[model samples]
Target chain A: MTTLCCGGCSWPIPVESWNREEGVRCPVCGEKIVALVFPAIARARSGAQPEGLVSETEASCFYHPGSRAVVPCDECGRFLCSLCEIEIDGRRLCPKCFENSLASNRLEAAETQRTMYDTIALALATFPLLLFWPAIIGAPAALYTVVRRWRAPLSILPRTRIRFYLAALFAAAELAGAGFILRAILRLPRVQ
Target chain B: MAKNKSIYRKLTPRRRGIGGFSQLWLASDHILLVRSSRFVEQYRRFALADIQAIVVTPLADHTPWQLAALGASIVWTLVFLVVDSTAGKIFFGATGAIAIGFSMADIALGRRCRCYLHTAVTRELLTPVSRLRSARAFLERIRPAIEAAQGTLSFDQIAAIAPAVTATPADAPPEVPQAPGYLPEALFGLFLVNAVFVLLMQRFPNELDNVLPTTFFGEFVILIFALARRGVRDPRRLVYALMVIALLFMSWDAVGLARSFTHYMGSVMEQSRRGRPAPPSLTGWVAFEHAPAVLAAGWRMVAGVAGLVAAWFERPVKTA
Candidate 1:
């Protein structure tokens, strides 16, 4: 049986509550919840059925010897049956190649995380001024970070290099201020 | 970076939470939920073809925050009227205006809500689409993408596919015992105790120095426990609301304490520079610092009473 659970409380909403333009109150949590069911829910899922090779002349699958090959893997060019063919991002790949692409982050659809180095550089440049002493260390560190990660891939979403520019400016100013302080300290009379 | 340009479009505005900020992005074949906490950004993608349903539940949760803001505005306005100094008057008046502004903005924005996306294997809450209007707009915006992937089903078709059936008595599951409300009760009890401690401090200023801090510490610990527990199981709305208010008040108190310490340290340095005796203990100085202590105490007392009353009326539910 197909079940649609209430969002508020994980209780399975009765079929009576389905397809209502106006929402129905969840019996368990009493929260008014509206469900927009799609045709996919009603559609039956079909699994792949690989046919056995009729003759020895037929091309056999790399993984399954008895199964006839339908297509070649996009990455490694290995013969694959319908069951072994995995399609993602307009590319048909075998199971091993698909897993490899995901592990290497070559497939954008499979990427699950990205480090935002620009935000880190900006934070390093600015957040240390609160204590007023760590800027001496933070300034060079921020500059180094920006220089090292300037060409690094940013968020998958569109973002500009404004943060990197801002960090560089702040780091330069901090370094200049530190230089002045160092000069002043050196110029001061030594007390024995 | 060039490879990903124009590949994903933003579907919703970024929403900030205690853990991080999250935003939704619409990809060609899937929708992505990106959560950025400091330097790292995590992503969860749901394919358009696999989505079974999108459920939206309108939440009346904003009332607590609105009430809190209104209460804060009144308290600050009262402080503004009672204070004689011009600086105090200006600060209190500005704070009052800001609080009222927040309350008005919250009302004008519309109702708050939560949107959940369901698939065959996973059910996930869409965090960025928390407002009712945004949730609707989000549904509308993604409808085309979903339709392109999975053809639409008419109401008649859906009804025919999932025919209505009256539930039989034998099909019903047995009633399960309700979980104990010890965490919320403890949290509310600590709020009451903290309010009493504040009142006692007003009476015998120096007597309960260590006791007040201990109570505050204990309250924070219990509040954290309640918040973490609520994540696993459903709790009463009032209890969650009270916990949020308590967290906000505690954060404000911590900032006030920090400011007081800085001011006290500056005063000590100035006095020592002039060859004069330093001031008294930091705890004593903080206790006497200019803040809305009485207002905070009153709010704590009110919240504690409300929470206890709500907990008293909590009804149990049976699981299927």
Candidate 2:
């Protein structure tokens, strides 16, 4: 069983202080805290144990030879005992397949972070305009980034491609500005 | 992405901070905290069934901003009254009105707070529900969804079950050594000193050359030290955040000063090349540059006082 702790000081909150509507002051930090105790807090977790084969005719688990197989792993289609089967996102997978899916980022539910290339492209296109000189390099870099990462998987959250469009527009303008500067320099009078 | 869009509903308003924007989203079985810094999106999910508590601690930090705004308004109004020129009077009066408006708006928003969500595995701060009023509303809104997922336990049932589970001595958290508190105190003290220097510079513009550089240098050095000393588990997180904001403000001030100096120097050089008499010194020219310096000083003083109060409250309780 796990005990509830004060968020402020991480001190064990007294049982009497739990589920108070008005809240209670943490004895350690003197900060007011409200604890919502759910039924799950009291519910004990039961660990799955592999069942032993009653007879030699019973199919044995792929990982555990002595244990009776309960189900097949969704990914690898190997027989797994109850103890070896891991359920994640409604799919029961073997330990090896679970590790593989997590490592390869094949499971969407397992993803914790993503690099937002659109934001990077937008930042590059806009922020460099402050210095003016960096725009020469920033513009091309931003353009390259947009083109390269165009097909890349976007944020898990719904996001628009407006950033890419804006980046391309700004980069084009910067390149035009640079070209204009070059043309102006070409048109300048030569020194004797 | 489309599947996620359909499944996850926005649970809280996006709160923008120096690091990035953070927002809460409700999934079928979990609540997700998404922190998106421009180039990266980080996710933290807490399953509804596992959530043990949602604690909201009242904060008085918002008062400092209100006080600072009110103080600035009063100062600007006084300047408006004193200035003889119509343009000066109008500008100062408008600035005063804007400051007063900001103070009023802040007051109307209700008391500020920090909300913390507790699960079996982790405790996370929910930044979106940062006001006491909003925290209550947010709790009420999410209660049904949470109840549906985990089922409800009455107060009596919770009280009955708590002692049996919590009585074990092994559940007690190990005593950890407290982090040193001097860094925040020193940083806040420096903020007050720097504020005083800014006010003094405004009062005696002729001394700006000596005072400004010293103040800026000392500020950066102390700020860097304070930031470096910050530990991951340090309880004075709000103070560190304030220090970061102050650093950003100071950096902006430095950039503004450099730009002004560059422009002044360029003008002086142009005058010299044209064989005309040079303009007055930079100090004399910028003597009446009142707004930014005054506002900076006002906010710094407010932050200094507020940070000191917070630090005092956060000091470890001694036991016999």
The best candidate in terms of lDDT: 1
DockQ of each model against the real complex? Answer: 0.41, 0.32
Give the Å shift of residue A170 in candidate 2: 1.5
Tens digits of per-residue lDDT for model 2 on B1-320?
23324467888788788889988888888888889987999888888887867767766445765776688688877788867789999999998888888787678878877787876666688988877787887888777888998888887887677557554334545566665658788878888987887788777778765567676788789887777656544666667777878878887777767666766777788888999988665553452257878876887898798888877877666665
Q: Give the worst 10-residue stretch by lDDT in candidate 1 chain B.
A: B164-173
Worst 10 residues of 2 chain A by lDDT: A1-10
Clashes of 2: 0
The best candidate by TM-score is: 1
> Which CAPRI level is candidate 2?
acceptable
lDDT of 2 by residue, A40-104 (tens): 67776565889999999999999999999999999999999999999888999999999999888
Evaluated at residue A10, the lDDT of candidate 1 is: 62
Q: Candidate 2, DockQ to 2 decimals? A: 0.32
C-alpha lDDT score of every prediction, in listed order: 0.80, 0.79
lDDT of 1: 0.80
Model 1 backbone overlap count: 0
